[model samples]
Target: MEVNEMAAEECKAVLEHASLGRLGCSYENQPYVVPIHFAYDGGYLYVFSTSGQKVKWMRANPKVCVQTDEAQNQSEWISVIVNGQYEELPGPQYTAERKHASSLLAKRSHWWLSALGERQMRVGDKLIEPLFFRIRIHSMSGLRFTDEKERRG
Candidate 1:
């Protein structure tokens, strides 16, 4: 999709409001998709995962795509798509990003402090037994389906 068509602010809003998303990549020319939790920073996606198949696959192929959606009610919905390259964030990088992400998460009224709070520590300590990847977005778009349908892609 053409980058000019997408409004950066609206796309960012959609990303921030949605926590769960689908990470898409390829393995042996076969496409793969996995559900995961993510944090959307200024223009990047932060995802945590244990070292295993997905992480290995991503390493072998850093290119990826992600989709996140949110619905305020039956009458309205918004979905955002991010196309990017994935890179494992090093210790220092993860620490800094984790602190910012955790702070934003903490600000949400529905956020479970105990669970998300513990994750913050694990992320800070790089002790989740999981690999942390920073998805550097190259292009982003959003689609809104409310009383009217609008798309930016």
Candidate 2:
């Protein structure tokens, strides 16, 4: 297999097409990672989530990493990594931005279910208020791997 570095445009394309990724955050030297559903727009990756461990960790340390990939097989794959800072979108000052995030995320069917469902499971019969946040992309890099046969073809 041959591996090639993806250009900025190619990386953006991957982020635009992918809705799921692993979000990595660190607090006090301990690292945590979890699967997240996100929408990439402009220079940020928007996410809808409940107040939980991740939220607390991110609040303490805004630095984060997001990784997503598309794999056809062992010999063919595209992977992207985004390094960014987290920004919470709260009401009052961020009303407009929150609306924009909501619109973009709504395009993905059942986008809110997983977040809400997880929150419900954690706090049974309790009111679940979802929070919106965005990862301000600082940099992105990606790699594409293609089998030698495919490249030659």
Writing each residue's lDDT as its tens digit, candidate 2 over 1-153 gives: 788999999999999989989999999999999998899999999998877889999999999999999998777899999999999999799999988888888787264656587668877844456789999999999999999787456
Give the clash count for each candidate: 0, 0
Please give the range of 10 consecutive residues that has the lowest summed lDDT in model 2. Answer: 106-115
Q: How close is candidate 2 to the true structure, as a TM-score?
A: 0.89
Q: Say what the RMSD of model 1 is.
A: 6.5
lDDT of 1 by residue, 1-153 (tens): 222334878898778767789999987898889887787787788765656677878889988999988776555677789999988866874787766655654454224445545776767754445445778999988877655333321
Candidate maximizing lDDT: 2
Question: lDDT, candidate 2, residue 20?
Answer: 88
In model 2, which regions exceed 4 Å deviation? 109-111, 114-128, 150-153
| TM-scores vs. true structure, each candidate | 0.70, 0.89
What overall lDDT goes with each candidate model?
0.73, 0.90
State the lDDT at 4 in candidate 1.
Answer: 30
